[model samples]
Target chain A: MEKTWIANLLPQDEYREKRLLYFIAEAVFILGVSLFLYLMVESFIVEMDMPGDRMALLCIGFLITYTTLRSTLTGIEYPDVASEKRYQKEKRLRIYSTIHFWIIFLFISILFKGIPSNLEETFDIGGSATFAAIFFFILNYLSLKKSYKKNKDLLDD
Target chain B: MSLNNDRKIRNRIAVLRAEWNLSQKQLAEELGVSRQTIHSLEKNKYNPSLKLAFEISLFFGVALQEVFQYEEEEA
Candidate 1:
C-alpha cells in the first residue's frame, strides 16, 4: 500500500535513532549541570567551614521526596517503553523488591535477637535509624499504591 | 528485540503504513500504542507480542504471515 507523498516523516529506524541520540544528549546535559551545582555548593560550604551533615541530610531528603512524588504521580518508564509494559514490569519489580527487602530485614532482626523496643534495647541500631527505616518503608508502600492507581488504566489500554 | 533472543522477527509495518499514507503517530494512535513502539516495530528493534502482532496485521487488513516473517538463527 505504498503511496507517494509530497512530504513525509523520517523513516522509523532513523526516527528511533534520532530520538535516542536526543535522550542521550539531554541526559548528559542534566548530569553535567547537576554536578556543577553540587560542586559549587560544596565549595561554598567548605569555604564557610559549614558542617556537611545537615546539608547532606537536606539534599538527600529533598531528592528522595522529589523522586517519590514524581514516580508516584507520573509513573517511571523509559523514553521508548510503553506505559502498559512499564506498568507490568514495575509491578513485578516492586513485588520482588519488597519480598527481598523483607527477607533481609527479617534476617537482620533474627541476627540482632528480635527487634528493639526502646533505646535501652538498641540491638546495635539507634532509635533514629529504626525510625528512618520504618518511615522509608511506609513511604515506599504508599508510593507503590499511588503508582498502581496511576497506571491501572494502562492495563485496559 | 532482546539482546540474547535467538528468534528473529521482521514485519512489513513500514510498507503498510507507507501504502496507507499513515504516519507513525497515526498508526500508534490507531493501535493504542506509542509512536516509539511503532518505530521499534518498523526497525525490528523490538518484537511485538502475539496479541500486538495480530492487532497490527488486522489493522493493516493483511494476513499475519503477510505482515510478519519469522527467521531462525544459525546454530
Candidate 2:
C-alpha cells in the first residue's frame, strides 16, 4: 500500500525536468531578442535622415516594450513557484526600466516644437535621445540574456 | 564527476511492492511523489532525491544500502 502510494506521486523528477525545459525556453527567447536588435539596427538606424531616424527609433522602442510584456505574461508555466517568482521579479524590473525609456523617448520625439533646419544642430538634439534609448534597451535586453544564461547553466546540472 | 562503479545494483521495486502487498497508487500517496515517479524509478530511468531515498528506506524498514549499493571505486 505504501509503495503503491508512492508510485502515484512523483514530484522531484518532474520538477527537475520542468526546470530544464524552462532554461531551454529562456535561452531561445534571449537569442531571439538579440537577433531582433541586430535587425533593427541594420534596417532602421544605419542610413536615415533626422526625421526618419526619429521615427525608426520610436518604432524600435515600441517593439522592445511589446516583446518584453508578451514574454512576461506568458512565463508562468516555468518549472516551479520559486522559478516563476524569480522570473517575475526580473521581468518586472525590465518592464519598469523599459517604460522609463519609452517615456523619455516619447517626450523628446513629441515635445520638441520643431526639428532644427540645420542638420548638425538637429542631430545634436535628436540623435542624443535616440542613442540614449538604444543604449537603455540594449542594457535591459542584456540583463535578460544574462539571467537566462545563468539559470540555464544551473538547471543543466 | 561521474559514477566510478561498474557493477549495477538492480531493483525489482515493482515486484517488491507487490510482495509487500502494495499498489502503485497507494505507494505514491504515502511517498508524496507521483505514480509516474514510481514508475520511472522502477524502470531505472530516474534517480530519487536524498529525502525520497530516506523515506523509502524507512518505509521498507531496510538500510538504504540494501536497496541501493555503491561498488568500491576501481583502483
Candidate 3:
C-alpha cells in the first residue's frame, strides 16, 4: 500500500499523461547520465587527445540508444485489454526486428567489405553506425505514433 | 463517458468493484493489471480483449454479458 517515490511522482488516474511524464523523466535522466559520462571520458580517459566532434557523437549515440530502448520496451499498453497489449507487443517486435536486420546487415556488409583499414575508414564506419541508430530511433517514434492513432479510441481520457 | 460510436464497450466494473468491496488498486492487483487500467475500464475509456473480458467475468463470478454491454452502431 505504501507508494514508492516513482509511484508517487506518476499520475495515478491519467494513463496517457502518466506515460508521457514517465517518458520525459526517463529521457532527461538518461541524457543527464550521458552528459556526465562524456565529461568523465573527456577529463580522464581520452584527456586532451579526443576530438570534440567524437565526444559529441558519443553523447548523441547514447541518447539515441537510450530513447530507442525505452520506447521499444515500454510499449503502448491497454493492460486490461490482452489483445491490445498483444498487438502492441507484435508491433514492437516488428520494429525491433527491422532494427536488428539493418544492424546485422550493416555488420555483415562492413565485415565482407573488410574492417575499416584506416582512421578515416574507421570514422566512416562510426558515422554509418550513428546514422543507423538515429534512423531506427526515428522509425520507432513513427511506429509508436501510428499505433497510437490506431488505438486512439481505446486511449480516450 | 460519452455514448459515441467510439465507445464500443461499456462496463460496470466500477459498480461491481464497489459491490465486491475492492479498490481500483486491489482489483487491478487481482486482475494482474495496472491501477490505471482498472480506472480506464471503469470509466469506459478502454475495451478489454475477449480473454481479459472472460477473466474479469470469472473473477466476478458473473456472465460476460453482466460485466459488459456492446453497443454497435448501425451501419
Candidate 4:
C-alpha cells in the first residue's frame, strides 16, 4: 500500500523505477517543511529570537512556497497534449499564478513599507521581481501555445 | 529522460493500434500504462525501457523489430 502510493506520486507515463527516489524525496521534503514550519512559528508567532534575521525567514518562506507549488504540477499529460480543456486550464493557471505572485510581493513590500523610508528600495526590488515574473509568465504562455499546436499535429497523425 | 534526446526510436504503435481497433486509452489500460504514454509512443516523443518495449511487442503479438525500429543517429 505504501509502495503503491509512492509509485502513484509519479505521473502515469513516468518510470516505476523512480518510486524509490520519489519516496526518499518525499521523506526529505516532509522533514524540511517541518523544520521550516517549526522555525517560523517559533520565531514569529511565539516571538522567540532565532539565529537568523526575519529577512532570512521571509526568503526561505517564499522559496518554499514557490517550489512547493511548482513541484505539485506534473505538467500536461501526453493524451491531453492539445486538448482545449488542457490548454484552457494552463492559460487560467498562468494568469492566476502571475497575479498571486505579484500580490505576495506587493503585500510584502507594504509590510516593509511600515518600517523606514526604505520604501523606495523595497519597491525597486519588487519591481524587478515582478518584471522577471511577467517575463517568465509570457515565455511560458507562448511556449505552451506552440506546444498545443505541435501536439495537435501529433494527435492528428 | 528528456524529449530532446538526440537518439530517437521509431515505432508502429499507431498503425498497430488502428489495426487492432484499439484506442490509446484502451491500449494503455491493456499495457498498464497511461494514455499519455501511448500517445508519446505513437509520436516518438519517448523511448520506452527495454522491458516495456518487449511488453508492447508481446501485447501486439508481433516481433520486436516489427513494432520498433532503431533510427541511426544523424551525422
Give TM-scores for every candidate, taking all chains together and pairing residue i with residue i: 0.34, 0.36, 0.39, 0.48
Best by TM-score: 4
**Tens-place lDDT digits, model 3, residues B1-75:** 765764377888988988999877678788776665676778777677577789899999999999998877435
- Residue A79, model 4: lDDT of 38
Clashing pairs in 1: A1-B19, A2-B19, B1-B45, B1-B46
Tell me how many clashing residue pairs each candidate has.
4, 25, 0, 0
lDDT of all predictions:
0.62, 0.58, 0.67, 0.68
- Candidate 3, residues A48-70, lDDT tens digits: the string is 56687997787677766665555
Badly placed stretches (over 4 Å) of model 1 are A1-35, A38-46, A49-69, A77-133, A155-157, B1-75
For candidate 1, the TM-score is 0.34
Instruction: Please give the interface root mean square deviation for model 1, in Å.
Output: 10.1
Quote the lDDT for B21 in model 3: 92
Rank ordering of all candidates by lDDT, starting from the highest: 4, 3, 1, 2
The local lDDT score (0 to 100) that residue A70 gets in candidate 1 is 51
lDDT of 2 by residue, B2-25 (tens): 965565554556766876788765
- What TM-score against the true chain A does chain A of each candidate get? 0.39, 0.31, 0.37, 0.42
**Regions of model 4 farther than 4 Å from truth:** A1-79, A103-119, B1-10, B24-40, B43-46, B58-66, B69-75
DockQ of each candidate's interface versus the true one? 0.06, 0.08, 0.09, 0.18
Backbone clashes in candidate 4 total 0
